[model samples]
Every structure is written in structure tokens, then in C-alpha cells.
Target chain A: MNYPNGKKTNNKPVTNRKPKQTPNFSNRGMTLEEDINQSNQAYLSSGRAVIHKKPTPVQIVNVDYPKRSAAVIKEAYFKQASTTDYNGIYRGKYIDFEAKETRNKTSFPLANIHEHQVEHMKKVCEQDGVCFAILRFSKLEETYFFPAKKLFQHWDRQNNGGRKSIPYQTIQQEGHFIPLQYHIRIDYLSIIDEMYF
Target chain B: MNYPNGKKTNNKPVTNRKPKQTPNFSNRGMTLEEDINQSNQAYLSSGRAVIHKKPTPVQIVNVDYPKRSAAVIKEAYFKQASTTDYNGIYRGKYIDFEAKETRNKTSFPLANIHEHQVEHMKKVCEQDGVCFAILRFSKLEETYFFPAKKLFQHWDRQNNGGRKSIPYQTIQQEGHFIPLQYHIRIDYLSIIDEMYF
Candidate 1:
């Protein structure tokens, strides 16, 4: 027997596959957002820092208030965020960053970021906030704390006809590698402490 | 003629009344959100600080993408925010605050706030962020910057069977009055400058 995609029937169809429900303990299927959020929760619980990912921006066009139930948004659109994703206070220092996960193993593309977000980061940097990007290379299973100052150099260079993506080697050199941990999955705050504190 | 409410027709029916679109150059009808947003824009343009009101939280359940148009959120619901409405970096300090407008002449009711917001504020304060509440007494045309520490006192007192509202007189005594300016309408940062910076 053969599958629709011409593979042998021994391999199940991709659509028929479901995530295993067994109680296995590993961060194999988690996204970067989930990892950072869990890490933030750990930090918050331990009084290490107070950080939060801002909610996804949405533009509501219509809403219906049923008699007693909560108001339901019937029509809406996702909005382009005017700022970075995560921001909070850490030991009295303003912390701000956008998190991005790219499947590409060779380079982190600048297209992953928006222009106004970059402008917002620039303003945050001017205000002396510890602003940076949390870049996760999923294929390589590596994450880095890329500072806004270093990112600005690359952003400006790209606008001036330079490479559109930061070379993986360049990120390895300019950005601090964020190691995965047992409790705090992506321990980016450790990097912040070593660099800013 | 007589209006449906039985008032004399010399006055236009209340339901039919519309705000004059004559672009009257005045801040007479602006809400607290509008005033603060404009003030934030002014602050951003003048290189003073980077502050922004976080977008309203929404939980999207379903979305539809047409052939060419943008994705449309077909089902969603408003979510209770986990943090303050406004937060940013100002003078190298993490500025966190929630803005509220009340028409009551005697006091600002504690019911206007949520328990989780207080919890979030406590965490921000623990991190030494400059956290506060921007209270606007619309009826009195007065705005005040009430520090988070002072707010915590009233909150605790209320939880312990004290007054459920902070009396207007008490606010007048403890909170710093935020003067309305042409550019920075709320002018809460000026209070932060004096108190924190």
C-alpha cells in the first residue's frame, strides 16, 4: 500500500498524526513564545523580574453583547503592532524586546521585523532601556539575546544595500547565546544581568 | 411638539443630539484615553520619553482569510488585561500606570480597579518601577497622579473593611495634581519627574 503523497503505508499521513498524549517531559514541541512566557512566569514567581508579553494587537470592528454573557467580537482584524512584544522592569531597568523564531538555519532574516517596530526600539534605546531581540533559530535549536544597538547597525546597513539577513556567524559573534534550562527555559535575563547589570 | 421623554420641544430630543462637527478648537470633549495618547505622541516627538498605552486585550477564536484581502477575525472576545493599560521607559525608569476617569465628585471608587491589576502593580513596584494611577475627575475637570504606594494603602484599607473609595479630599492631599498643558495634556510625567527622577 501507498499513501497519497506516494510514501509507503508504514508511515502515517501527516494530517492523521497527533501530538503524543503520553506524560513525557521535554521542551521538544514548544515555540519560542511559550518558552519565554514560561521563563517569565518562573522569573515572576521567584521575584527575579517582572516581564510580560504584550497581547496580540487586534482592531475590533463589531461586537455583540448577548443578554448576560460576555461581549463577543464579531468582526475584527489583526493590527500591526507599533511597539515590541515584551517589556517590563528588571531591577529598576526598563526591559524591551521582540521575540522571533526562524526555521532558517543559516541566517536570521530582517524581514521578520517591521519598520515601526524598529523605530520603536530606537526610541526605547534612546530612553536608555535595555532593548533587544530574542532570536531563536529553531532548526539549529539555538536562541540569542541580540541587543538593539547591534541590531540597529545591521538594520541601517540593510537599508543602505547591505545583506538583508544577519549571518548566523555574525549573530553568534555579536549576540549572546541564551542557553536552555530545566526550569527557566530560555534564560535571557542571565544575559541581561551580565551585560546591563 | 413634545419630546418622547415629555420635556418641552424647545430643546432638541436628547436621542437625536449629535456632537457638533465644527472643529471647535478646544479639549472640551476629549476622553482620558485620547488626552493621554496625544500627550504620549508629544512626549515621543520631543525626545522626552517613550510611553504608550497597551492595546486592548482580545482572545481570537476563529479567523478567515479571503483570496486577497487581509485576514478577518470572525470570532473573538475581550480578555481581561493582566497588567496596567500604559507602560514605557521614562528617564531610564520603567513607567507603569493605569488611567481612569470618574465622574463622581466625592471620591474615586476602588471598584474601578481589578485585583489582578493591583497584583501586577505590586510586582512592578517590587521591581522598583515608577508605577502609579492617572485619575481624572471628569466632573471636577481635575486630574491627579496617585502613586502606587499610596494606592496600596487605600486598597489594603478597603480590603480590611474600610471605605471602598478614596475620598476626593484624601486624593487632593496625597496625590500630585497634574496640570493640563497645551502639548502634554495629562502631564503625568512632570509629576514622575518630581517624584521619581
Candidate 2:
């Protein structure tokens, strides 16, 4: 296709082209984690909330400190996380949640959520902390803020010989949809305000 | 010197000796991190609070995922943590703190803490989250729960040509001493209950 700026559609790799300054609303090719991270940066800068993704858990078996350089990990293995991926404080309340994305448009598979994570969420809920899941249906391009209580119910039902996944229609009814924005890609705080505050 | 287990005072390199089943109150050779982790586990099991120390941050540059085998990180580097080492919920309130130990008996040096961590504590305090530091003096064998506000005061004062470290006497007066116990090695939540609750 011809370009609007009077340039031909160049198939040659445009290595020197500068990145776009403004964000494109329709072109959301970024992963859910990246979107959430960007949104968290916006929230933190705006003094709305203070959320951060925990680093990937790694078990270091051996490390070498050579001369005056930085320590380098020689032998390490990734460890499974025992808690949710994201946590912080908002409006004097503790917030905790896990983010997950699936390509299945019909349902969100139960396998996406781990048992220990559910247990962690249960403990947080018992402590009266706000715990939930940010589930994204990638194929459908829909993201929802699903409550931990509802997830627990479904998890229990699955353990009791129920369906292994939550249907999209059920999620639409029970969960709050998070709309994308320019600055805050996934404005989940607005949903929290409406639901909790 | 000999132990009270009726064993001879033979120094023949006892490598096969069994670990003690009961905790010793006098001999605390474990690091402050281990002590806090043990305390957190105790609190979690008793359903008192849900606190966890964050895993050490690392930057992975290369990984090898062989078939039917776990992923092995071939190259990685240690990364500086942007936030405190530990945080979680206690009594429906957000709790955040950093645990640090000093071998020097005079003062807890500011060099142990990073600038970004102080900024993070500032943000957490602004969000009304309970923030503090667990300072331990190895020589004195004392641990104290120093409030974030107090730390910030000293931090800012140091920036304005004040002392670079907080004096040991100052910590004794301003901080709450965490007593070592058999079950909950470092009973910090007790101090939290007294100070915040």
C-alpha cells in the first residue's frame, strides 16, 4: 500500500526509523505483563497506587565474583513462585493479584492458575487484602478483573467434578472489564474504585 | 570448651553430627534474613499474618531448555532490588520493610540501604502502608524495628551534612527491640502489634 506521507510501502527493513511517540490504541501487540507494567508506571507516577511485579524466582547454585566486576551466576534454575505476581498498596488497602493470558476465547482454563497461588490468595483474603486476577482472553482481546472469591468458587467446583474452565459468558457476568487507555493501558484501578471504594 | 550434650570435648572434626532438634536461644548464628524467614513461616502456619521475603532479583541473559529437562540459566547477573526485601499484609494492613545487619557495634551504616529503597519506602509511607527496617547488630546481638519515618529523617539529615549512620543508642531509644524466641526466632510481629495495632 502507498504511504500517506508520500512514501512508497518499503519492504526493506526500516532499521533506522524512530519509534512512534504516541501510543496506538488499536495496535496492542504487547503482552499482558508489559501492558500492566506500563500501566503500573503511570499509576505510580500519578500517585494513584504503588504496584510492582515480583522478580522471577531463581535458585542460584553457584556464583563467581571475579576481581572487581559484578557477581555472575554460573549455575541457576528457575523456581516456581509461591505467591501472586503483582502486589502493592492502594488507598491504604493491600492489593494483590495475578495476571494471566490465554488464547482460548471460549473459556479461561483452570490450569492457568496454580494451586499454591490460590492458597496464597485465600490467605490474603482472610487478612482482608484485596486479591484478584487479571485475566486476558487474547484471541478475543478482552481483559477482565476476576475476583479471587469467584475464582475460589470455580476452583472448588472444578475439584468437585465440575467444568475445568470458566466460560467466557460467566466471566463477562461476574468479572469487571478493564478498558484500554492511552496512558494507563489497563486501567484496573478504575474498576477497583467502582467495586471497592 | 564443650557442649552440654554429654559428648566429649574431642575436636576430631565432627561432620556427621546430627542437627539439634530444639532451637537454642543463646546461639543465634543464622543471618537476619533466615531468622525473619523462619518467623514468617511460623506466622503463616499459625494464621496470624501473611508475610514473605521477596526472592533475590536477578537478570537472566541466557537459558537452555532441553527436552524433558528443567530450564537451566547459563548466564545471569545479580540485580539491585528496587524495593524492600519483604512485604505483605498484617491485620488487613499493608506491611513493608527491609531487614539488614551490621557487624559494626557503633551504628547502622546508611551504605547498607540503597537510595531507591528509601524512595520506595517514602512512596509506601505516602500510601499509608506500614514501612520500617529491621536492623540487627551482630556484635550486640540485638534486632530493632526502626520506623521508616525515622530512617527517612536520618537519610535526609545525612544528605544535609549530618551523620552518615544512626547511632546504636539512638536505635535503642527510637526502635523497638525484637526478642529472640524458640518458635518464632525473630518475633517481629509482636513488635508490630505493639507499635501499629
**Which candidate should be chosen as best, given DockQ against the real structure?**
2
Model 2 misses residue A151 by how many Å? 0.3
The residue-by-residue lDDT of candidate 1 on B51-135, one tens digit each, is 9989899998999999999999999999999899999998899999999999999999999999999999999999999999989
* lDDT tens digits by residue: candidate 1, A76-160: 9999999999999999999999999999999999999999999999999999999999998886777788999999999999999
Candidate 2 C-alpha lDDT tens digits along A1-197: 43334444323221212212222344358889999999999999988899999999999998999998999998899999999999999999999999999999899999999999999999999999999999988867777889999999999999999999999988888887775555577888887887788
Cα lDDT listed for each candidate: 0.84, 0.85
Clashing pairs in 1: none
Candidate 2 per-residue C-alpha lDDT over B27-145 given as tens digits, one digit per residue, 9 for 90 to 100: 36788888889999999999999999898999999899989999999889999999999999999999999999999999999989999999999999999999999998877777788
For candidate 1, the docking band is medium
Model 2's interface RMSD: 0.5
Q: What is the alpha-carbon lDDT for the whole of candidate 2?
A: 0.85
Interface RMSD of each: 0.6, 0.5
Q: Worst lDDT window (10 residues) for model 1 chain A?
A: A13-22
